[model samples]
Target chain A: MLKILRKEIKAFLKDRRAVMLTFLMPTILITVFALAFGSGGGDDVHKIALLVCDQDKSEITKSTINDIDSVKMIEVIPCAYDTAIDLIKKGKRTSVLIFRKGFSDSVKNLHPLPLDFKYDAARVQETGILQSILPKALFSGTVGKLITKEYFGEKLNMLDSATRYKVFAALAFGGALSDNNGKDISPEKIMRVNSTSIIAAQVGNIGLVQAVAGTAVMMLLFSLTGMGGGLLDEKEQGTLKRLLYSPVHPSQILLGKMAASIIVAIFQLSIMFIFASLVFHLHIADKILPLTILIFATAVACSGFGVFLATLARSRSQLQGMSTLIILSMSVIGGSMVPIFLMPQWMQNVSVVSINYWSIQGFYDILWRQLPIGPLFLTKVGILLAIGITLTLIAFRFFRKNVMALE
Target chain B: MIEVKNIQKSYGEIKAVKGISFSIHTGECYGLLGPNGAGKSTTINMLSTLFPPDTGEITINGLNVKTSIEEIKKILGVVPQEIALYSNFTAWENMMFWGGLHSINKTDLTKKAEELLQLVGLSDRKDEKIKGYSGGMKRRINLACALLHTPKILLLDEPTVGVDPQSRNMIFELIEQLNKDGLTIIYTTHYMEEAERLCDRIGIIDSGVILAQGTLDELKRHSEIKDVIVVECSQTPDEAYLISKLNLNVKVTDHTVYIESNDSKKDLTRCVIGCSEAGYEIHHIDIQKANLENVFLKLTGKQLRD
Candidate 1:
């Protein structure tokens, strides 16, 4: 076994081109993916410039402008209606909000306050943010003004009939002074606390991590398949027969080849991850141990898969075809090429059978979800190991029967 | 010593080796001489334990090949027909790897590998990758790799195929030297001259069966056409006249007349005298002994190279 291992290692080392290509390929792939996916930093806030055309010029319109400006992500710019339209047309501002005339009087008279918005539909993120926050800002601005009016202790008889009617109408709709219970409601007691159950974890550059891990796994399979061709090469060169003639069992030869592939895979993965960490700042250092274990398990599983392909193929060309078909299919369906979440639920479920699925999911746990190294990590590692051991056993059985039998 | 008894092997419906048997003594070089597809490699493969025989048994140095393959492997060295090398690796590395497989100690393996490389005239080029070496150099390394463990028996299957004459001669010299050093060898080749020059005993097989097996002289005696004499005539001779005059197996082609006889010397003189008296000028007379080629043709009714 050691002899075979030494020979395999020596052969690979001597082939400088193969070694260079093995390491260089993943670097190129990661670079391409990072450039394509655009570093999913998730840190940059979308800035939407809102041009407000206050035709009403009423206190209500001013308060609404302030409410919109209060949100840190949206910047409010007051301008004339024509200027706002011209700015939106020139792409200077992402959106424009127009408060029609009688906006305050309409609210006071229990009539609908007309507000119009013109936005850049091309800017999806900015448009989405504006669409969600604009309505809430408007509603909150109206309610805040009505509460201010009630705090002044002004009676309805002191104001005009239309004004009085609008104030009561605004209060009725705002739920601050609803008469359903026939009790006066205090705005201070109506607490507006914003809370979220989702805690933000320090997952650095998710897009870059996914790109690194996905490309690493895919290239691991590609490189291991190429390594598996060594078996066919030996058979063709008659070195396999020579090894069999030695004082060793056939299983030793299989084991030695598999070990060599696994070692090369681990080396390939290490170089890629180190490159990713240095260049892209992938946050693997926080969970290094589990990450290492997952990488090792993935390497083993991929190596075993390579052996199975080699043993199953009768010729190098056959191996080439089969490996390309299987590896590319697995990469496509296993969230290496496209995220599993983006795929249909059925396709995502089907991807569970792919080794890359488990490998990439394990990496996601460590690098993205920041899940602790617990049952989830163990399950992924165990499944990968089981796949490796089982496939390796099947490969050995085929080798013993087909290759070692001198077929 | 190696012994094989009625070893038969078949692939699908084709019988590759049909119950053939042979043995090699402790220090003798035995050759399996036949045409292509005559089961020469199959027989060698069986002896090397590359595959198990369908029937019968093979024992090397008193170890049964079926039950004691590991023990048999310890005493046997196989040089396949192909180069069977990792071309990317240096010659020294290849030798070291094969030696390591036999569990040779590292120190001794290095020494042995170096010595064998020197013997094969590759010591200076040992550090170079085999892919850069010439065909002859590759052949030399192939032989060196087999001899690293210093096995008692060496099985070379057509080692000289596709090699240049210079390398072929070098291989011949190497095999002779190893045999002189008291190593048993089993050589398989389709080249009759290689068998004739090297093997102490030759076995001629065809279509998975051995037609004959014996020493050079013994095989000649088995041939019905014992000797072949060629007479080159200055003038074209009539086939019928030459046949009638010599009263022996005579054939005329172009300007030469061939005669086959049990006694070559006597027949040569008679043919020369008869051709001279008959006014046919005999420019040259050549006498040749019956070789493996003729023996193969006579026994199998086909040329050895066919």
Candidate 2:
């Protein structure tokens, strides 16, 4: 077995295609994506620039100006109203904000009125997302803006048009979001939302990694089915008969072939590991015992499936066709292409039968989640073992029925 | 020595080898001759313990091929009709792999491989990958791999098919040399000439049955060629004119003459002085008889290759 493995590894190394597939191209893919990720690609908080046009520069206007800059989604750009509008029209800025001259005087005096502002819709849709966020944000931001109007400081609480309009707007638009429990919304709440992202970001990335790596590994099993073709190639060449006549059991030949395949599968598996680590930053820790078990079982499943595919096929072309169909269908239905959560409930329920899904879920609970140590040690390991054993036995039995008798 | 006794194999009632039996003694080459689908491969496969014969026994030196398969394997070499070699591996590597399969050690395996490559005259090309080698080179490598571990019995299935004549002759010489070294060989081929030149015994198998089996001369006796005599005379005669005038059963070519007659002495003595005067130097008188090729034809109802 060791000898077989050594030969297989040498052969794999000699193959330029495997080298390109396993190492070089994946490095390129990882480098490309990592640079893309760090740069935020096209859309993110870092790249947004906002413009504000204040026709009325007053204390209230200054306060509103301060309010506009507080939001993280926009980077403030000061400009004349016309210039701001022109910037929005030219796609130079994401959006522009305008405050008319009487906006502050009307609010300080006992005036019964409200203000309205307008801007280009095209910029808002394509480039002006940050501009439209300011008006409602400015209004909703001031805890004192919606307080009942006080007449002459006697606190004869009055409901004026401006306050009325604000109340009416709150009732109309913010009903779904209102914490009727009267919980005062604060910056702490906002900070909590942002900080929770550390864990969420980790989970999200690990999930994506598991999803992608699981698929690559599962499909890679198909590539190693070429190992089985070694047998068919030998048989086609009549070397199989020669080997049979030698002082070796036909079983030993099968053993050598399987050994060679497992070695190749190991090569492919390590490629997957490095790829996931580099591209997705797949986290592996000291829980290598479980990792080792998962890798071993996965190797078993792939090698067995390879032998099974080889036996199922009578020729190289037949193996190619049959394995292609089998591995592809399995990968698709098993959630290798898409997350099972994204599937309909019925489809998700059906995914339990998919080996890739179970293996992925096992990986999620183990490598991705790093969850409760109990589930990691027992359930995940058990399920992976079950899938691996069941699939291997199935493949072996199918091979015996189809190909062993072929000899 | 190898023994196959009434071996039979079938594939869903399509009897591939129908109760055929043959044995080869030590240091002898036994040829299995038949056409395509004649059960030659099926019989050989069963004897090699690849497929169990449905109802009989094959004993290689007292080891039943069915039960003692591993032991049988340990003592046998098989050269398949098609060069069974990993095209990606060099000749030395392939030999090492096959040698390793039989549990030969690294040092000994390399030594044996080198010697075998030298024996096959592929020593210089031993390090080159089989994929780049010619068909003959690949076949020779295949033979080398088979000969690893020095099996007592060698099974060759059409070892030379579509090979250049020089390579084929080299392979033939290799087989003879191996047989001389006490390896019992079961050689199969459709080439009647191969059997004629190499095999001490020949089995004429057809349609899953051995229709005839014996020494080359014994099988030839089964055919109706009772006599054959060739005369090397002192003179080149008008062979056709002499045949017409004397009413002789004669076949004449160049400086040689042939006759199939009940009384050889009368025909030869009468023609001797006349042929001598025609100025043909007498090299020698030679009389050769029919052999396995004739018996194979008579039984198969066709020539060997046809």
Candidates in order have lDDT scores of: 0.78, 0.65
The candidate scoring highest on DockQ is: 1
Cα displacement (Å) at residue B211, model 2: 2.7
Relative to the real complex, the DockQ score for model 2 comes to 0.44
How many clashes (backbone N, Cα, C below 3 Å) per candidate? Answer: 1, 8
Error of 1 at B151 (Å): 0.9
Instruction: Provide interface RMSD per model, one decimal.
Output: 1.2, 2.2
For candidate 1, list the clashing residue pairs, or say none: A108-A166
Candidate 1 Cα misplacement greater than 4 A, ranges: A1-200, A405-407, B233-257, B265-281
Clashing pairs in 2: A94-A128, A123-A128, A239-B84, A247-B73, A247-B74, B234-B280, B235-B275, B235-B280
User: Every prediction's TM-score for the first chain?
Assistant: 0.55, 0.49
TM-score of chain B of 1: 0.89
> Could you tell me the TM-score of chain A in candidate 1?
0.55
How accurately is candidate 1 docked according to DockQ?
0.55
lDDT tens digits, residue span B88-197, model 1: 99998899898999999999999999888888888899999999999888998898899988999999999998888888898999999999999999999989899999
